[model samples]
Target: MLTVDEHGLTVSAPWRSSERRIVGVIRDAEDWVLKKLDVWNAFPARKQTWTQDDRIRYLGRDLSLELTQDTIASLATLRDGDRLQISLADPTHTDSVKAAVVKWYRRHALANFIDRIGALAPRLEVPVPRLFLSSARTRWGSCNARREVRLNWRLIQAAQPTIDYVVVHELAHLLEMNHSRRFWKIVASVAPHYREACAELNRMGLYYMDI
Candidate 1:
C-alpha cells in the first residue's frame, strides 16, 4: 500500500522483494510519485490549532480543550461535557499541547482496556492473562498462545461498543488460537452483534489512526 499523509508518502513494499528491487521500482515511478506528492501537498488538512478553533473527537464525540494550571505537570483529563481539560507546566507551548493530548489518550486507553477486559473476561469464561497497549500500524488487537492480549491504544477514540467488540474478539483467541468457526462462536457468545461491529470496523479503515 502507498499512503500519503502529513508524514509524507509511505511505500509498503512486499517483504519478499529485495531492497534493490523496491528501489528500482521507485526509480521507475519517480515522476509519477512526485506528481502525486504535489497533489497531496495541495490537500488541506484539518486545523487542530490550540486556540479558539481547535477540536478533536473522543469516543465519537467532538470536544475542545481547556488549558488549566495544576500542581502536577503535563496532564490532560477528560472532564464533563465537551471539554478535555489539560494541566501542564507549559500549556502555552504548542508541543506541550500535543503531548498533553496524547497523554490523555494513553491514560484513557489504558483505563478503557482495563474496564472492558475486566467486564468481559468473566462473562466470556476466559482468563485475562495480561493486557498491553500497542501503536501497531496494521492490527487492532492480538492474542498470543500465552494469552497475553495487546490492544491498539488508538481504540480509545472509538465508541464503547466498538471497543467491546475488539475486546471480545481478542479474548476469544484465548479459547481458540486460530480463527476457526469455534473462535468466532466464542466472540459471538460475548458480543452478539459482532458481525455488525466487524463490518463497521472494516468500514472505518484507519479511523483510529487519528492523533
Candidate 2:
C-alpha cells in the first residue's frame, strides 16, 4: 500500500487483500511520502527470536523488514559451515544498538546480488529482471513476465549459496517461464547442485522466521 502526502491520503496497492490489516498515516511535510504499510512495520515483530545485525527488522506482525545499515560483515555463528554474517549491523554486539541487522542486510543484499547478477547475466546469456529491494514479509523473490523482479530484502540473513540459488533460479526464468523440466535443466546447468542448495535454503528458514 502507498501513503501519499501530497494528496493527503493513503493509496492502497490493488494487489493487497482488503481484509489485511493495513494502515496509512499521512501527515503534512515538505515532500510527498508513499510508504508501504507492510514495509513500514517490519521491525520489533521478529526482533526477539533472531539475532541479526542492523541490517533488517520486521515491524508489526508480518510487516516488511527494515534495512538500517549498508556494509556487510561476517558473523561468528555458523549455520552448517556458512557464516551467519549480515552486511547491515551487529544487533547483539555494537555501539549502534538496535533491532536485528537483518533489515538493512535484506535491502542491501539484493542490491548487491543484483549487481553481481548483472556481471553474471551476460556470461550465461540469461535475461535479467529489473529487481527492486523491498521489505516483503512472505516472499524472498518474485518475477513477472514483464521482466520486473521484486525480491524481499530479508534474504541477507540467509546463507550465501541460498542467495545464489534464488538469483540463479530467477535468472533461469528468462529462458523457461515456469518450473518445467527445461527450467531445472537450465538451472542445473549453471548450478550443478541446485537441489541440495534448495534444501539448505529451506533448512535455513527456521533460523530466521518467528514462531
Candidate 3:
C-alpha cells in the first residue's frame, strides 16, 4: 500500500515483494503521487514563533495574536472577532503563550463539537454520543461501539463545513460502522457536500498537525 501525508509518500509492501515491483508500482501511480505532493508543497509555512502580532487560525479565519502581561493568571480571549488576546505572567514567553492559546482552543473545541454533534445527531436518528477531545496527529474524528466520539481538538481550526463533515461521518458510523456504500450514503444524506469537505480536510490536515 502507498500513503501520503505531511512527510510525503511512503510505500508499505509485503516482505516478499521485490524492490523492482515496488518501483513499477510507484511508476504506475506517479501522477497521483505528484499531485498529493503538490498539495503539501503549496501550503504556506507554519508559524515558527508564537509571538506578538502572530496570526492563528480559528474556525477557518485568521486571528492576530495580541500578548499582554497579567501577573495573576494566563488567559486567552477572542476580541472583535479577529484578534486573540492572550495574557500571561510572562507575555514574552513563547511556550506560555502557546499553552494558553492551546488551552483556550481545547476549551472551545469541546463546546463547539458538542453543539455540532447535538445538532446533527437527531438528523441521523442517533442519540448524541459522549464527546471527547483528541490530540491525535492523523485522525480527525472517531466513533466507537460504545457510542463515544472523540474529535481532534485541532480541527477547531478548520472551517465549519469541514468540521461538520467529520461530525456527520462519525454519526453515520453509529448506524453503519463500516465505510461501505450504505455508510457513505448516510453521510451524504446529511452532508451532501462531504466529498468537497473531505478533500479540503486532506489538503489541510498537515497544516493543522503543525499546531
Candidate 4:
C-alpha cells in the first residue's frame, strides 16, 4: 500500500516481509519515486501561469483555454465552445480568471455528480445520498456514515465513465463502509465494468490534472 503525505510515500509491506527486503525495494525504486514527486510539484507552478496555450480536460477531452477580453461592457465570465470569455475591469488579471474557471468547474461538477448518482442509486435500490462537491486535493470521493457522498470538483476534468466509477464506489459505501469484498461486490453489481474503470482512473492519476 502507498502511504503518502507532505514527505511523499512510505511503502507499506506485507506482514510476512522482512524489514531489510522492504528497505532494499524502496531504495531500488527511489529514482522513479522522485520523478513522480517532481511531476506533482511542477504542476501548481504551471497552473498559476495560465497562458492561452494552457489546457484543461472536460469529459476526458483536452481543450486549450483560450482567453478573450471584453471591454465593451461589464459582464460575467461565460463559456462558449471550449473556451472562456472573460469580461471585467482587467481581463488579464490572473486571480479573476482563475476564480471564473473555478466557478465553472464547481457548477459543472455538482450537476454531473448529481446526474450520475441519481441514475445509479435507483439501480442499487438505495435511497439517494446527499451529494456534496469538495475541493480536496488528493481524494476523489468519500462517503461518511451519514450517507452523505462528497465528490472532488476536480473530477470534472475526468471522463464520464471515471465519474460513474467514483459515484458508484461511494454509493456502495452506503451499504458497506470498509473496503471489503462485499463492498466491491456491491460496486460490481451497480457498475459491471467497474474494474476497468478503476484501472483507467488510476492510470489517469489525480495530480496530473489541475483543479
Candidate 5:
C-alpha cells in the first residue's frame, strides 16, 4: 500500500515483508514525504551506501532501496527537460500525491496526443486507436486489437520527434498490426525520420521511472 507522511507530506509505498525500506521525497520548503515500505515479512541485515546520483537508497533494510533526498532533487529538475510545462497535483496525503502527479501528467499527455491524432488523421488517410494516458512500463505506446492505443504520459518529457514518431508508428499499426514490411512502408511514408526518433525514444528510459 501507499501512504503519504502526514507531517512531512511525503509519498510512501509499503509492502508486507520482514525487511522494511522507506523512501522519502522533499517537494519544497513546505513539503517532504516519507513513504512506507511494502515487501515480504522477513529479512536479514545488510550494509548501506550513499551516492549523489539522485536516486532511492536502501540501507540495512529488507526492501533494498528507498528514495533518497538526492532523488527528490532529481525529480524536480526533470519536470520539463524537453520544454514541456511542468504541473503537479499532489493530494493531501503523501502517497496519493505521487500517484496524483503521475496521473495528471499521463492524462494531459494522452489528451494532447489524441488531439493531434484527430488533426492529422484526415490529412494522412490514417487513423489510430483513441489514445489513453497510462503508466505502462513496458512500452511507450501500444495498439490493442480493439483499435485502442495506450501511450505513456512520460512521452511529453521527450523530444517532439520522439513523440511524433510513436504516434505515427501506433497509427500505422491500426492499418497493419504487425511490424511487417508493409507496416514499415506506411510509417516511413508518414515519418521519414522515424528511425532517428525511435533511437532517441529508446534511450529516454535511462532518465525516468516506470512511467
Candidate 6:
C-alpha cells in the first residue's frame, strides 16, 4: 500500500517483497504519486505562533484567537461564535497559550466523537465501540480487533459531516475489517455522501498538519 501525508510518500509491502517489485509498482503509479506530492508542496507548512488575533480552525470555520492574562487559572473558551479566547497566567508565553488551546480541542473532540460513534454505531447494528483521542500525524482514525477506535484530535477542526463519515468508516470495521467492496457498501449505507466527505477530509489533513 502507498500512503501520502505531510512527510511525503510511504510504501508498505509484504516482508518478502523485492525492491524491484516495489520500484515497479511506484513506477506504474508515478503520475498519481507526483500529483499527491505536488498538492502537499503547494500548501505552506502551518506553524502556530500562539499570538493574539491568530486564526484557528474549528469546525470548518476560522476563529481568531483572543489572548488574556488571568492569575487565577489558565483556560480556553469560544466566544461570540468566532473567537477562541485563551486565558492564562502568562498570556505572552507561547507554550502556555498553545497548551491551553490544545487542551480545549481535546476535551471537545472526545465529547463530539463519542456522540458521533454512539449515534452511527446503531445504524450498522453494532454496539458503540470504545473511542480514544490520537495525535497521529498521518492517519485520521484507526480501529483494532478489540473493538476500540482511536481518532485524531485534529478532526475537531473539520465539519460535522466530515467527522460523521470518519465515525461511520471506523465503526464499519466492526463488520468488515478491510476496505473491500462490502466494507464500502456498509459505509455508504450510513453515509451516502461519504465520497465528498472523504475528499474534504483529505484537504483538511494538510491544512491541519502543523496545528
User: Which lDDT values do the candidates have, in the order given?
Assistant: 0.74, 0.52, 0.86, 0.72, 0.50, 0.85
Q: What is the C-alpha lDDT profile of model 1 across 129-169, one tens digit per residue?
A: 69999887666788788789999887777677878998998
lDDT of 4 by residue, 21-72 (tens): 9888888888888776665455333344554546666777766666667766
Candidate 5: which stretches are off by over 4 Å? 1-97, 209-211
- The runs of at least 3 residues in candidate 2 whose Cα sits more than 4 Å from the true structure, single-residue gaps closed, are 1-100
Report the number of clashing residue pairs per model.
Answer: 0, 29, 0, 0, 19, 0
Top of the candidates by TM-score? 6
Per-model TM-score, in order, reads 0.71, 0.52, 0.82, 0.72, 0.52, 0.87
- Give model 6's TM-score versus the native structure: 0.87
Cα-lDDT of candidate 2: 0.52
Candidate RMSDs in order: 7.1, 13.3, 4.4, 5.3, 18.1, 2.9
Clashing pairs in 3: none
Report the Cα lDDT for residue 141, model 1: 82
In candidate 3, what are the lDDT values of residues 110-185, reduced to their tens digit? 9999999999999999998999899987678887999999899999999999899999998998999766689889
Tens digit of per-residue lDDT, candidate 2, span 1-211:
4432211233444455454344332233213453433223333444343433223322211222222344565333222322334334544444342333443455457667787678656755966658777555445666778877666566666556666666777778777766667878887877787777655544444334432
Q: Higher-lDDT candidate among 3 and 5?
A: 3
Error of 4 at 123 (Å): 0.9
What is candidate 5's lDDT per residue for 1-211, written digit by digit as tens?
2322101122333344323233222233223122221111112232223212222211111121122333222232232222222222321233533443355456557677887678656555866456677566546677788878777777765666667777887788788866667988988887889878755544444343333
- Model 6's lDDT to the true fold? 0.85
- lDDT score at residue 30, model 5, on the 0-100 scale: 21
lDDT for 63 in candidate 5 is: 22
